[model samples]
Target: MKQETFGRFEVGSCSRSTELQEERELIQNPNLNPGSSSLSSVVNECKKRRPINFCQEEEEERSLKKRRIVQDTTIPEWLVNVMMREEINGYDPKLILAKKLYKSDIDKVQSRLSLPSNQVVTSDFLSEEESRVIYEQSVLKNRTEGLSVVLVDPLLKKHVVDLRKWKMGGNWNYVFVDGWNQVVSTNTFKVGNVYHVWSFRSGGGKLCFALVPPRNSSDSGHGGSSSGLSSR
Candidate 1:
């Protein structure tokens, strides 16, 4: 009985040692199949992802927006078709932002559409001189003015509007003030409706935007796939 017990203990010890040795070999051997062992596969995957995760975390920390802005390239064909007009015929439209209307957007009192800086996807729509003006105004303690731009609705009606960088409390936001009420009333836009805003240059190099509504009433806003536009 004693001999049999000792024999079992010795076998168990040898099995454990063999496993440890195999683990070391697997780590050292670069030629081994990645899927051969589950443990090694997990380790390899983690090693590959470590740098990517670290970079993303670092970028998020540095940006006040907390999220990276990626340009939306896959615009819908129907939207492109509608934007084909004499004024902006040759210019290719780039998506600037997509958002669902908030209560303040449709409110008569607010009389503006607020575009949060954090939620903005592509901000390169502004020219160097335009960006400089916004930066200069942002630093001022009082009496900041807005830049006038032409905003075209779905029906190709132009609304001359003032785009301003308004700081509310602690957060900074971009707003289409002044003539925004006209846009809301003319289009009959309501809260919770999703719209896509595209930027382009006119023949005379004037900065312009085209606002595209969701493809259908049932379409989900906020740039969802259901709205016929991919989410960033």
Candidate 2:
């Protein structure tokens, strides 16, 4: 029904209807409401502004932690010279060196280890490249080839052993044990294990060395794990 006193659009104008709908929408949407503040809007804004990923940050932190592991396995050059000089100058170096077993240290040399009468030499006998460094020392280098030198035990002066430079193969730079099998048998060395060698006597025709067994796996932190190895 039309009001006789009003114009054609006076009943319900489009502008009036649109203004009412706008008020309803503002009331229904909390984010658009001018009368209240929304925490969700603040959170969305923060999320949009920040492009950072917490998971990536965590991973990088973990990687940095892992990289902190001390990597000082190989002995320094100066220390090698000190050990050699201690032997040559009659000071008799007194230090314990640890070495992890490699395939070359045990597997490839199983035959040499088992031979009761045959002598074998290895740079592996000394700690931290000591065997190689000793060979380069003037005392042993200047001596005639195949000259046997007694290595007296540091802990036990009476415990005397003999060693020499054996030039069979592999660049002719190796510490040859005149009685290697005997030493291995005496120490009960097993493959896939780390061993310790100590030096004491070098001058006076004696060079002393001692063998020590690994306390546990953790102590073999020097690396070159000897696991999954066979004597064959």
Candidate 3:
């Protein structure tokens, strides 16, 4: 009998016979394949450790873009002023002023103001009619003291004319009331008309004046109609 050494395993004459018999048995049994179990386990571990796919990454990016767009909307300042003026006057001064200043040419006027096209058409701040009113009120206020008066309406077209202009037969008038009140009376020169009067009293003091149209008649009543009162 011969002895042999094969890698880590040694076969002596007595053990060689037993080893040979064992090797022959293993060859006949197909189930005894070497490393097959370990190879199968390695393959399953690799499958479980695979990387993520591409579609999920794109979905996250799209969601972020949508959120950013929603956060960027805002309103302008000029429109805010127009809204406030309208609230104070109870009329759309912006619209009336726009008409007077632009003479019904809204597009030309908007271009001059350098307003955006979308703003001119869709802004809630001021319409063409409201802009016209504000413009007239501003012009009148600048021209003369007590000559131009703004009514509660922001719209200048619906303005209550000063009584002084009418008293001078110039379509309006200026009359002085107590320091706390003023009257726009059409009754003085025109005979029969309603009085549009405004009165104010505050911590400062009482200040009042009257607006009357100019009169052509010789009936010059002086006591009730006097010079404009100084605001104290």
Candidate 4:
């Protein structure tokens, strides 16, 4: 019986060692998340996120409106159809899809500053396919010149935001913005911090926009915007 017990202990030790090794491999794997240096913080962020207030703009400085909230906590599970190198569109991965960020899923939102690639990117925090679909429905089908995205807080119940069409020079990457110059002036963005951005169209006005902070930013005492913080 003692020998059997010892054998069981040996098996358990091997199992734990294997599990630890697998986790280490996952943490080191770049494809799991090309931007993150380590996975411990990310895994914890995935396990839990802090809350953010949508209505009140977090900062008085308009320049620092929205950039860099919490650490990059976006999960691999949030991605769809993990593509190998062979399945990409261009030399860069093409048509990579991320799960939509609802008002609640702010933690999963990735920073524009953290994006590793720029092909088929959008002005809003949307994938290329997503922005394209909205464009088709709002502009092409309606026969309008163009319709932009506007973001509003559900609590505020306000309408109408200025929308602009920005070109990516010779390239095809662009995101819609209400305050591009203002965001540029505020150099308050960190590369690892995550931010949530969304747009709304209401009462037949131009595209309006809104921003959300990471769930963890509330009590972390970080020097950043609680209302609108993002690394753009």
Candidate 5:
């Protein structure tokens, strides 16, 4: 009876040991029971690590998208076109285009247009000294022709006379006025027929034209007129 009881106890102990070994083997090989509690714990840890890595990737993607949006929003297509056109035209078109685009002001547009045109004129008879002589001649002729004369010397930086106090050049003819109010007195000095006059202050400068009437013409009261000086 004692031997049978000991044998039974030993057998039971062996069975329990076998069951524990089987469970340890199953835990060691993840592929054996991938859904086991121990496997489930590993999967949970992997899942946790995946989300952290995914969140970092998502943040990087969002930052890239934000930078792209900012770059696209800052530059407009029209402004780019204006910049390219300016390169071709040799002037800053952006500022000019802006003034026109925003305001329908004709004066502003005309002021910008007054910049030199592309026309070229050549005169072989007018050397630098001869040119001065011709300018003086033109001024005297202008005075006789009832036009006003004003001489402008860029080098002197002084007006021969105060421009404002002088009367507007005669109504019938174009005027020749210098930076100083000095009217050309002789027929020997003449500037070009088209002259550009700029004032130090706001109201006085303009472009003037000297008109020589054709013979046998009846338009005595109506002489040549200057266009750019008049306000828009």
Candidate 6:
């Protein structure tokens, strides 16, 4: 009888089907001796013992570090000053968005601040709990209400708002509602005015935003020249 060897796997005058069955058994049965099993089967068993890939985890950490670097560089000096204020003193504030206000933003009927998906600076700024709440309420249950977030205006006044995703013209937009009217009214925000939105965690780890007005706006009471996100 002729024997063919494949890295310790020997087939001696056996049918192809038999060979295949034996190979499958050797791979599936963990108790099988490595001396009798094919090299490939032994390797597969070793892989099963340690499923985690440390290389992949290291790569993900590197990616997150890069994102943090980008966020730090993008935040402007004026915004940093706002974050450092006694009333604010935010935790690692990152500029997450900037948009020119539209009529719909301040419209009493809408009563929401629409942040288009494309205009956002970073989508991963939400904490795990915040993301889970938004996903369960907005995506799973299809509820109009979502995660509650604290929004700090340029004046450093905090307003609690509901954050949810809304589909419009086949694209999804993140919107602040159910308290946005207060922010608009309190800030005296006007249409066509540009505003920068910054995100940071509160001391208690709550999601918060700083809605910065145009640098020249008297509404903010921060005496600086008119500045938009043109340079950014």
lDDT of 3 at 164: 22
Model 1 TM-score, all chains together: 0.58
lDDT of 1 at 79: 52
Model 6, position 29, has a per-residue lDDT of 85
Which candidate do you rate higher for TM-score, 4 or 6? 6
List model 6 lDDT by residue over 93-173, tens digit each: 776777789999999898888889887877888878878788878678865579888886655566889998878777888
lDDT tens digits, residues 176-223, model 4?
334333442333434344444433322332334433344444432232
Every model's TM-score: 0.58, 0.32, 0.16, 0.27, 0.20, 0.59
Better of 2 and 3 by lDDT: 2
Instruction: Give the 10-residue window scoring lowest on summed lDDT in candidate 3.
Output: 96-105
Better of 3 and 4 by TM-score: 4
Q: How accurate locally is residue 61 in candidate 2, as Cα lDDT from 0 to 100?
A: 93
Candidate number of the best TM-score: 6
**All candidates' lDDT scores?**
0.64, 0.39, 0.30, 0.33, 0.28, 0.70
TM-score of structure candidate 5: 0.20
> What is the lDDT for 89 in model 2?
41
- Candidate 2, overall lDDT? 0.39
Per-residue alpha-carbon lDDT of candidate 1 for residues 71-172, written as tens digits (9 for 90 to 100): 244675545654454545536567878878889888979998888888777778898987766666665634457677878765445788878788876778
- Candidate 2, residues 1-232, lDDT tens digits: the string is 3222232223222344445555565677746744344534443443443334455889999887666422222333322432345334433444334544444444335322211112222223344444444455424565444324433221112222334434444334334344543444333345565554445444663454544333333333222132311111
lDDT of 3 at 31: 81
Question: For residues 1-232, could you state the per-residue lDDT of candidate 3 as single tens digits?
Answer: 4435544433433344344554565677658654566444544443433343445678888888777544322221222222233223222212211112221212322121111222222234333554444445434544232322333211111233231211233322122212212211211222232122222212232221122212222232321212221221
Model 2, position 67, has a per-residue lDDT of 64
Candidate order (lDDT): 6, 1, 2, 4, 3, 5
After superposition, candidate 6 runs with Cα above 4 Å error? 1-73, 85-88, 142-144, 217-232
Cα error, candidate 5, residue 34 (Å): 2.2
Measured with C-alpha atoms, the lDDT of residue 3 in candidate 3 is: 38
Q: Tell me the tens digit of each residue's lDDT in model 5 across 1-232.
A: 1112222132112234344555675777746776677656655544433312345788999999899656433433222222233212212111101111111111222211111112112123123553344345444443222222222221211123211112223322112233212222211123222222221111132212122222232332222221111111
Count of steric clashes across candidates, in order: 0, 7, 62, 23, 22, 0
Off by over 4 Å in 2: 1-93, 102-174, 202-205, 216-232
